[model samples]
Target: MRLTHSCIITNEVKKLSEFYEKVLQIKAETSGDEYAEFPTDCGILSIFSFSLQESLAKGSSLPGSNRNLILEFNVANVDDEYMRLEKLGVEFVKPLTTQPWGNRSFYFQDPDGNMLNFYTKVK
Candidate 1:
């Protein structure tokens, strides 16, 4: 089986969509105010409206309640991406640091407090 995409259920679709666009540096293809998608070479990252999701799968999920999952992005340069996000006023949960496994990365939070990591494999 292959992974296609991951969706974030959010109460503020537009707000979160805008935030992702700024962070990813790509425009989201939106479906009304209910859904938005940022397509990438790896897969599509999507945002779904809470109301719509509730209607489809009632009481299955909660908005802004993510604590254990960290959405990760593979970048060309962790340092460059860190500086760019820093200037955009993105709040960092952890500073850029090299992992013992040979990955250089940084952690930050989305508007809904969802943790996100951007990393580059170091040789």
Candidate 2:
């Protein structure tokens, strides 16, 4: 089966969604006060809220409250993308570096602490 959409749980979904829309140039739609959906070239990007009390009661942690997951965006040019995004005030874990796999990449974190990587093939 093909994947359709993926979601990140945040305490402030609206704010995070707006950040994505503003900084990453993603146009996202909000559903009342619950969630946001972004239609990308490949698939839909979704963000929703997780009530800490309810999730803790159910013994499940919020999606990004813990590590072990990473979301990556592939770009045509990592350096150009990094400069553009940096100008928009996005925080990067590190500047774009060339990987042994013949790609230039960098890492960052989302509002909820989900690790993100942007990569492009090195020529």
Candidate 3:
């Protein structure tokens, strides 16, 4: 089955949504203050309020406890993107570097400490 979207559960929906909007350069379609989504070429990146998640499925998921998952995005130029994000004062977990797999990439974290990666394939 094809994946449709990935959702991040957070207590601060507005804050996290705004962060993603700035990083991705896309406006989110929000549902009140409980949910927001950024539609991308691959799929939708969504944020759900912890309250909303509890109401829907109690204790099914935890907010701001992501330690193993890294959301990766493919960009045209990783260096340019890194520079732009740096100017915005984004919290970077790792600086821009070339991977052993021949990808130029960098890692950063959201306000909720969710890890994200932007990378470009070396030609």
In the range 1-123, model 1's lDDT, one tens digit per residue, is 888898999999999999999999999999899999999888999999999998999999899999999989999989999999999999899999999999999999999889999999999
Models, CA RMSD each: 0.6, 2.5, 0.7
Report lDDT (Cα) of residue 15, candidate 1: 95
Those runs of model 3 whose alpha carbons end farther than 4 Å from true positions after fitting are none
Q: Sorted by TM-score, highest first, which candidate order results?
A: 1, 3, 2
In candidate 3, where is summed lDDT lowest over 10 consecutive residues?
Answer: 91-100
Model 3, span 6-119: residue lDDT tens = 999999999999999999999999989999999999999999999989998999988899999999999999999999999999978999999999999999999999999999
Model 1 lDDT, residue 13, Cα: 96
Count of clashing pairs, candidate 3: 0
TM-score of each: 0.98, 0.85, 0.98
* Tens-digit lDDT string for candidate 2 (10-123): 778777887788756878788777788988778888887677435545645455574787777788788888998888888998778998988899988887788888899877
Query: What's the count of clashing pairs in each model shown?
Result: 0, 0, 0
TM-score of 2: 0.85
